[model samples]
Target: MTSTAINFNQVAYLLITGASRGIGQRMAIETSRKFKPGSIVVLLARSASGLESTRAEILECNPHINVVTSSVDLSNASKQLLEDIIDKSLSKTPVGSFELAAIIHNVGTIGNVERKAVDMSDRQEWEEYFATNLFTVGVLNSCFLQKFRECAKKLVVNVTSKACLVPFKSMGFYCAGKAAREMYFKVLADEENDLVVLNYSPGPVDTDMTVDIQGRSNAEEIRNYFKGLRETTTILTTHQTTEKFISILEAGRFSSGDHVDYYD
Candidate 1:
């Protein structure tokens, strides 16, 4: 089938991490609305309650769409969650085909405090941040890329942060981790494969994480920065960001090495 022939209804599956809130939750709902009935969506989060709520919301939007929820702490790099998902895909049900159309890596973390370079004394904290943000993306990419390689259309959309491109003070660890994850896709896009990988920054949104960060010490300065960003940058609602992402995925506009900003 041609790329255009791959409609939402024909999509076999969509696996998304951190789907309980923020960009992940919005993306799940958007995918459900855009895709055809009976398309399965696997939602992963650390909160079982939140995952169930998200699944319920998606089902309400499209009852015919199959929603599966998994509560797992992605911060644990040793857990082969991605591998397990691929293994399950291989064991098809009697009713449908076994294929994953897309995988969205939206898992992430923010440090508890904004620390200066000299204040970052704990090496383990940095390691923990990398484990959650960078390592998990690598694991998922390896798993999904292998599983979907033979399929006609496969895509990986990583929801990264603007910090990957422009560094912000006190967010060194977070920036480092995000940069690493973005670079992974940068290299993977060059590999000859059926998969299309794209690293995307969703810009700033009115999310819980952003609110918490804004509540920190430099609140005034941060608020001013955001105000300036609103004037100079394109701040997207979760819905708008999700819509653009789906458009890009459906259009097959993504290449291996491109870094996409949600504002654009």
Candidate 2:
């Protein structure tokens, strides 16, 4: 892996999706503290109240930082709608006002983990899954690039998963979505040499999603695997995983587009 120096102190425009709770909320608040005063932080999610809670916490951390929260349903949003949301969020602060522009694509769905691969015959189901996990990501990244093209440094982060490489039975939708999303960012990195793109796998953190998987996965082995992590007290807390994530961003090492894990 290669290392590059990133100045975290610079004024920045940071946008994070799925910022209502879990890793996204934690990351949004933690990363906000690292920015200079007058920096902008845009939080997007379906839950309006949750985003407000995140915004409140961010303001509490640094009242000087500008925080904008928008409720967006990524699952069914049209490309034009996504672009409009981006425009509305970015309009809170002037365009050429930041030295660094970064977006963390943390929004996603687990899909129907109860259904196995052979049962996944509905094209609508697949399209909905890809809409949230893949299509919106590409649309948002393209809009971000165009809006912040003048920034001195650009960072794009895809919150990827180990499932992207390793298959998990009964998790066909989730695994496939993650795999496609990861490759999407890798290609983005290849095409945009000046951008710093990272596919970060935050490991099995103790979140509601993990709890859902533990109880809901159709595969007994998969359920047991997550249950074991919880039982052993090995599942990482949101704060713990966010600490590692922040360190990785601050360090700015690892070649762009490399799939870096929390353990790594």
Candidate 3:
């Protein structure tokens, strides 16, 4: 939980997934602007084009910041494939050369199939949700710790969902994955001391994904809930929420396994 002043002058790096849009993209840009000049940021996403656009925005904010883009479909990628990508990316500039400051698991999904357990076609949607939302965080956190165990200021911020704490009817799989993700990080916190883990729920921010969330579900309760968030303007935009997220990251004050919301 305790952290002293970070030496921004030192070479540092941040790895963030889902960086093509939403809070992930804003996090990259704002973090880069605050990091030491020439610090490196690795952006991971499924969209090469979106990653490029994010990189451009980041550089526009801090011209000296270095940006690396990795376009891979995490949903279907094997562990070896993910490991290879991490290996090559680290080798490009050497993890030892910089302090691996942060790893933000901002990638998650509500699943393409929006249905309750009883209505599910099979385990396909549940499995897919777990793969992207729950599985990847554990694997990437493991890989990151293996490579940067010596980084004294290592931080892991998992972009979780409040849905983990509360249940949603049609988003059963998503809720399950997020709940699993929270517990996974909590246990990891007990097992590791070299890094600080924060399970963060960004709340229901208005994004491209949320817009589509309106009618994709079979349940009227779930559909109306999402639609109301939009119609009533109850949601915060990604930019509006990034400040609080950055504050948490920069504060470096939370204990490992701390679960916090955006307003918290």
Candidate 4:
């Protein structure tokens, strides 16, 4: 069904991960702009300061928009910590404060995939990456669904990457984790009929992570590859990405379990 309305009453709350910077931060600000006055948005990230920055940005845009910031490190996280964050964010929320609107998995890491074979990848490093990248996505998603299943609508937006299909040289961790996440969501969508799951590729946004990729490896090919993308006109700004996502959500032309690339 082609949907194109931003009806705030339909949703009671918005939960956004990686809301500190890049596309995630922009999405939070823009979403608040569309939401009615006093709408609530919960920002989750590792850095308290980062979450605060996003909250400040949102409030600067709309002072009356209710903003909640939580800092939970996904890497090496404790399940209890995750539960606490959820409990604190929602337990005290007044009824009818905000339907759980959306859960955005915009947090990710470009692993230190230096020129090395997958077999030789450090086991500890692999665990750290998996814990945050893929594992946390599952945990947060499950928590959101369990907490807000009765809500009218719940859309799960998993931000995936081209790396899911195209493996970078020595970037096995990133590729594998994203590949797994894509399938996991596919299955989750099949199992949960009431939820909306969308795996989105934001394309080459000029974020700090993208720039770091250029210097992470000494391989000329890798450096050149990223540099090319960074310099090209194809690199999307955070605002452009926010606009695209807003359009998708507004038009309601999204489907669960499938992947959508920004360039597409």
Candidate 5:
């Protein structure tokens, strides 16, 4: 169906990464209800079980929703896999009118090391964070932007962290990688395209990553810092952040480059 018809029904073809759990999984569930019954939701992540569980949850929420899962590691994703996904998506829906209504890039990683920049060892650990946070998002954006340009009515939402704006002391690598992804999209937004790309800071949510950080060596210091900033800040739940994101996406006035915050 054309976007004009689909828009009325909220039948969007949404593609979300990091959909196994956390913010990505929450987005999938929220979108299923926000969009139409026949809407196609494609989820990508590294865990097959998590993907399946997410799909099941979405199905439970909306039995008629179309949920597709791809268990591929975005960090080292092959070109063939990307091509295959695009081809499969096209095959499932009608051609020339299949718009990728929305895309959420939620895949990220945080290293365990708390050493200062000068004392940091094992450069490979930093490289891993960059691969997962920056490179993977860039690759996915390249593919999605191409497809979105071919169609119309596209929206790209990136799940960034507040750490990008206010740097966390020991988590320099994570902050830097997320910042790179933000910069890449900031430039992409300036380019000529029909797609509307938005970079979002979802705020600090309760997740496995945060729990890991709390258990780290510098946990007390980090907690103290956050506690001091708590009055000026707010931690969002997965549902709240995802809901706000979907509202912005549905508003359809999204510009090319805009940094949005869930807490604000």
Candidate 6:
């Protein structure tokens, strides 16, 4: 990941899901640079090696920052599991180390882009997708708030998409999941006066997920659209988009629960 000069607020503890690669990994490394020394960073992903690489990049940016990587699949996440992860991840930090906490709910799956809306009728498949995309996000956010209740300032971010606002061909599962996840955070922001919650759409980032959409989407137009982006070199790099995301946090002008896109 290429380093950028974006400086963020000094959060005491930060948690990032889907931190194994792409935007998540870069986000972790970049944000870790501005956190206070000795602050704890918890990274969750299914790939041990990817998490390790992310941890290494974080340490390289700020050696004093503490990074804890967990290889847990979000598809199987539970309240207890999430709570335990936070407790264990923050176990080493001293009391009253810092006053701020933040978490970015970034994990999501595209879910067989080759399947059209009608083909998404399998109950078992829907269950699995929701378990990872919707269920885990809610449980993890709740766990984070409870675990870090003492922190004076809390920020919760849901990495959302344009699909949440508009329908896309062959993206039934992804669009539904994103919409639900975005609304969940919107509700949380309305209910929780003590936290700053945001639904951030990262734009058309060039990642492995994009590659899947480009190669396997059932809609020819959708595949051609993504292919055209690559051909035109218009796809946003992970670093470029992440820089925008961090800058949004630094600006702090957006209202809580607002859906902010990179283009915005």
Q: Give me the candidate number with maximum lDDT.
A: 2
Residue 194 of candidate 3: its Cα lDDT? 62
Give lDDT per model, in order.
Answer: 0.73, 0.88, 0.78, 0.77, 0.73, 0.87
Best by TM-score: 2
Compose the digit string of candidate 6's lDDT tens values, residues 45-150: 9999999999998898799878999999999877888898988887867435765688999999998787888878799999999999999889898888887787
Q: Give a tens-digit lDDT track for model 5, residues 127-231.
A: 777777887677777776676565657776778878778878678777788788888888877774555778888877767777666556364788665454444
Go through the candidates in order and give the clash count of each: 3, 0, 0, 5, 1, 0
Task: Output the lDDT of residue 214, model 2.
Answer: 83
Q: Which one wins by TM-score: 2 or 6?
A: 2
Clashing pairs in 4: 11-99, 12-98, 12-99, 13-98, 13-99
Against the hidden true structure, what lDDT does model 6 obtain? Answer: 0.87
Candidate 3 has which clashing residue pairs, if any?
none
How far does residue 94 in candidate 6 sit from its true spot (Å)? 4.8
lDDT of 5 at 20: 95
Query: Would you estimate the TM-scores of all the predictions?
Result: 0.86, 0.96, 0.91, 0.90, 0.87, 0.95
Using alpha carbons, what is the TM-score of model 3? 0.91
lDDT of 4 by residue, 1-264 (tens): 313233443434788888888888998888876666656788988788888988998888777767889877877666677667766776676534555467888889977767465465578887888888988788878877777766766778888988898967767777888999888998987787777777888887889887887788645787888788767766789999878877776666666777888877
121-198, model 2: which lDDT tens digit per residue?
Answer: 999999989988998888888988988887778889999999999999989999999999999899988887788998
Please provide, for model 1 over 72-122, each residue's C-alpha lDDT reduced to its tens digit, 9 standing for 90 to 100: 888884536667865664456422353447888998887744676567889
The residue ranges of model 1 lying beyond 4 angstroms of the native Cα positions read: 1-6, 77-81, 85-91, 94-100, 217-220, 227-235
Q: Write out the backbone clash pairs for model 6.
A: none
Q: Sort the predicted structures by TM-score, highest score first.
A: 2, 6, 3, 4, 5, 1
